[model samples]
Target: MTQHFTAPDRLTAKTGTQWWRDAVIYQVYPRSFADGNGDGMGDLEGVRARLPYLRDLGVDAVWLSPFYASPQADAGYDVADYRAIDPMFGTLHDADALIRDAHELGLRIIVDLVPNHSSDQHEWFKRALAEGPGSPLRARYHFRPGKGESGELPPNDWESIFGGPAWTRTADGQWYLHLFAPEQPDLNWDHPAVADEFRSILRFWLDMGVDGFRIDVAHGLVKAAGLPDIGGHDQLKLLGADVMPFFDQDGVHAIYRSWRTILDEYDGERIAVAEAWTPTVERTANYVRPDELHQAFNFQYLGAPWDAAALREVIDVSLAAMRPVGAPATWVLSNHDVTRHATRFANPSGLGTQLRTPGDRELGLRRARAATLLMLALPGSAYVYQGEELGLPDVTDLPDEVRQDPSFFRAAGQDGFRDGCRVPIPWTVEGSSYGFGSGGSWLPQPESWGKLSVEAQSGDPDSTLELYRRAIAARRAHPGLGAGSDVRWLDAPEGVLAFARDGFVCTVNLTGRLVSLPLPGRALLASGPFTVDGDRFELPGDTTVWWTV
Candidate 1:
């Protein structure tokens, strides 16, 4: 049996305090979220139609992935026009209407801002190419002469994050740098024009009523002086674990500080979030200092294993690191970039975030639910990836021909398997796209997904969807769940984790064998069935429970 709670009223647009400090923000991948025009791809109108569902789901904000004008080279991350909406996604009028509709429903909007690079077809890049070498326009980007006698080799040894050399030679015999795909050219942040232009861009959107911006590749904005060589192999493996000349540079903090000042100028507690991948949690905290951005995504917690010890260590270290900066720690389980947590937990341990092999489905889902209970109980703001509430697993069997991830085409590239997690969500039990749109989905969905659709789970008490709704509502009603600074750890078995926050307690059992212990308090919620025996209760393996003393 599943517990139930009366759904809370719609969230207010802005709370009396800093809403983002402990808000639950949902990430909507626009390309696959919904489609209103039946064109098969999701659009702003599709998202507009789904606003009611999100409002009913109990999240405070919606963080939209890029919908800006682009050639779809790298899926809108490569921006050609920062101010215009992509034709496929609809017009500027549609964006305005969407923002208005969201606000009316008390949902704040956070748009993604990709400043680290721009589409090769952007006006600035085109002009730089036309003006040839030494052109003033070329100063806005990292264009340099190649090495060797004939200038045949790339300017430096730096490699593209998508595999192959980072430098691409132009017809004019000069090479340009791109950290990701060749179509996305890295910007020269040292150039004053880059800074001035982004400031103008920020004001443009803020004036249009956007609540905030999610800075993409936030750590890669400013490169090391002289474009030094990393002089290493398998460079992609070093990301988020070791420092490099091109990422997490000290100068990046200055850029965020400037953006933070602009954010402060706005009303309604507008915020800026950094999608920075730093080598350490302490270093990640640097981006969220009082004078800098409001929040940085806690990837460290997202990548932790299912083990109790590992999760506890990450929780303690993360909180300790953010305590000094006075920034609320952000917790996230799955996102657009990595494998879904539901599927990741199903497989064997040590696979980390990228798991290519399949695992036991039932076991994976059980642990995933247990993990969710644990995550929501922690003190801080939390991010819910699209479709995660439905316990959607990664669509791991997409054929190679249908795959569109740029990394998939390049050898030695970062795991090209991200497409597995970006499939359009199923909303109904039957439809060409499972109620995602009138037409077929851009990526094929499994036949088994019909059972997982929102329609299928709406009234079912044991559904994953219901669990999320209850958990979120519980979090909102309880004062100790969110915005707290720390948690008090309680003594438990080696593979079990128990903690208290105010009058609430969360206990997770990670071992395969059931454990008997004294009842903590009145049971508020449990991930699975439990057996009560006198003063003690038997907690099943891979389960979590919430208690209210």
Candidate 2:
């Protein structure tokens, strides 16, 4: 039996005036985005060279993962020097040039900032270690004495998000807290010096002409007073669903409020984005409360199942949460830490973000394309991860010996298989590394990726790359898209979702069979082929269509 959905009335118009509110930001993972020096590793120069690609793709900004001076222990998250660029990624001059070039291309550059931890090799940590116990330098971090009589046990029962104990004992018998790897020690946010140093670091980057910062682990900067124990095992699974003493603490908001002050001092609309994983969308909203950050990543939307009801519910809650605070909701499907959405939607629900089994590739790509259209029709800013526009799926066949994710080495830890999503993207149809670099990529590219390369898809109107280009162009030209704060739900049958914004309507079919729906307006775009009969349109399964009334 065919289901049908009737059109609904249009809603009052609500617009987003600020650039960040309705911006389309592209995330460039520097390690795999492109390699310009033939060093097999992506560098700042590579990003500069690719600035035009981004501008032509229609994204308003680029959010780059860290390229700071690091030990490469956690892919640049463990910063050895916040003020310097890693030699592997190029010099400080390269960063300045990239930022300048990006600005000249009419794009903003947002660099990653790791405030929760610093590399053990950082000068401050080195000095703290040499100063021994009770040194003022040690006060800058969470250094505490062990609990057992012999001081052999860790201070508390807390567990690292990456697995194992959260505390690592030092040579002097004192223990330090690290929610991630032992080489990345947590900073004591309560210390005035810690706060002051971060403020200075913020200024240093702003002075470098970078647009803003995408704060890493933004919710973990402050721990509850007394560093209370969570008293539970397998705590990694509870993250973003339950509150712990170590994360989403109220004190973190004060830190962001201070950072916001620094951001406002600049000429441009410099912003701070929180990569916060809180228990609820409402709790996530707190991170962007007027005086705090400008946006928080919408994980609720990203993690929702492919079911229409589930997606609609997530959208409703997300928009409601961000409304009172006057912050635009941010939508993202995939990132460095999670499996690609194409692969995710291809499989069944409850498979988690790190997939060990490859699902139906064709099904996944179809759903992913439909999902992209639906996301673009939504009211807030959207983030497109590098390679997602190419319809790239996670590389699930990497050998164990080639894995570099720290979580992969941990037992029973947070899904450590993030390496599958970090594989280098293909640029050309043929080459040692598919034209990623002359020296080959740091991570090997799959032979299958050649068919999906930019060179292969550039001119094909049916390619995912072309679909993205057209959708982004339509969003820019259509006044109804990317402006409103809410969606008006229309009458949709089960397994289908339909909504209307100002002068625009979007309908998605999530069922396995074709469904008939009233033709509310002229079709503007579609994820797949469809048929129209008189005033009704036949929407194919696993498809989305955008319409203009």
Candidate 3:
């Protein structure tokens, strides 16, 4: 065992608050980010090698997806251990090197914290199973009896997110519940010991000089009362439980407040970015109100229909919902879970209905640029996915054999969930392995990315990468986006979503035809042709433009 870092004596201003909020975050899936030992798996050392590329992107931080010890179920969400690094991702020494190098490159590092559950392989869970009812360790987790004394049925009728019964029969004849995959058991947030253990985990990482956490599934902390199966389930019941009460338990905030106190003592402002599924504005906003999370993801923009009217309605709803609680919303268009925006907005689905040959790819460059301006120019923190800035198209046609997500396995293609978005990123145009490495990758790189590497587009002035750079730079120039300022939507019609921040009026054209837009003020920047005198502008297929009124 080697220790690269014992503990930091002090953490200082060289790594400050601005390191996170104002920063652009590049998310790296450890198995797909980079391969260090040439074992065909991306590792911590691999990411350490690529720190400079992230710095070049003008981002302030990098959110490395979960690399903690896990059984690799759900790609490392099922944590077997909180303190040690997974051998597949590399050793703890590698993680220390990663933190040092990332900081040296002026990039703050925030790792994922899956506090919701742990791998069933964890030693503690094993101990609890070995010594059942009387074992003091049993108190560390939730314990409940089967529906009958004979234990013939589950205690409740609930379904797992992975698409099956939530409860599994222990070989010893008791029932333990799991909300997701059977191998990933839910943590008993109600247990005092569980809270104590998690608080200790906060100290372990903060003491290690790590920046902060992106808390995974913030809503899954607590469990429903009675440990009852899904609602009204006397028989074989399936699907989401009445876990909402226990799940974001008031006790969870107690743990967060303790962590907050510790961060203050160290003079470190550690942010907890929550991954929540709460759809309504007020519910999501409650998670980030001042003392709670610094930011929670606002996903309304991600699923918004590609229409000016639809997007504007979402923006209005988000602002009204998030502002009351002083919770700053994150406007994300794409992530590891959703289809790439270039696939959704850039490619007009209706156009395919008319013509056999799709014109979406050719116009994707302009529409993507328009989407960029719409996202960055808005009055919130904008999140860009790994390849989204480079206009990486989704691998819509991935063969069924290559899809690796368990969601697909569970639903068997019911929801058409997330298969295309999880493909490997392309780093070069031509190679046996998409320049990801000398050998093959853990997942196949999307062939559509052959012409979309950061290396290829970074140098070209007219590239989507360049346009993303400009949009980010423009946001930095305007202080209101990072900080809070009132946002007002301008009177723009369908296919054109327009808004004014302070006095800067930004408009986007989501239509295919070259519709002339009214230039309300001056044309500071124009990606497509439009008219004068009025704010009306022609938004050609997939094009966007911005200006000040």
Q: Which of the numbered candidates is closest to the native, going by highest TM-score?
A: 1
**Per-candidate local distance difference test:** 0.90, 0.90, 0.68
Model 2 residue 537 distance off true place after TM-score fit, in angstroms: 0.8
lDDT of 3 by residue, 200-305 (tens): 8877876666777888878777665665433454321211122243354445666566656655554346677878765366667777766677777776666666
lDDT of 1 by residue, 1-549 (tens): 111112123434344578888889999999899999999999999999999999888888999999999999898999999999999899999999998888888888999999999999999999999999999989999999999998999989998888999999999899999999999999999999999999999999988888899999999999999998878667888988888899999999888889888888776777999999999999999999999999999999999988889999999999999999999999999999899999999998778776676588898899989998998899889999999999999888999999999998988877898888999999999978999999888999999989999999998889999999898889988887987789999999899999999999999999978999778898998888898888888999999999998
Q: Give the Cα-based TM-score of candidate 1 against the true structure.
A: 0.97
Residue range with the least summed lDDT across 10 consecutive positions in model 2: 6-15
Q: Looking at candidate 2, what is the lDDT of residue 204?
A: 92
- lDDT for 311 in candidate 1 is 93
The residue ranges of model 3 lying beyond 4 angstroms of the native Cα positions read: 1-21, 229-251, 346-366, 411-419, 521-537
Residue ranges of candidate 2 with Cα displaced over 4 Å: 1-16
User: What would the TM-scores of all predictions be?
Assistant: 0.97, 0.96, 0.87
Rate residue 183 of model 1 by lDDT: 96
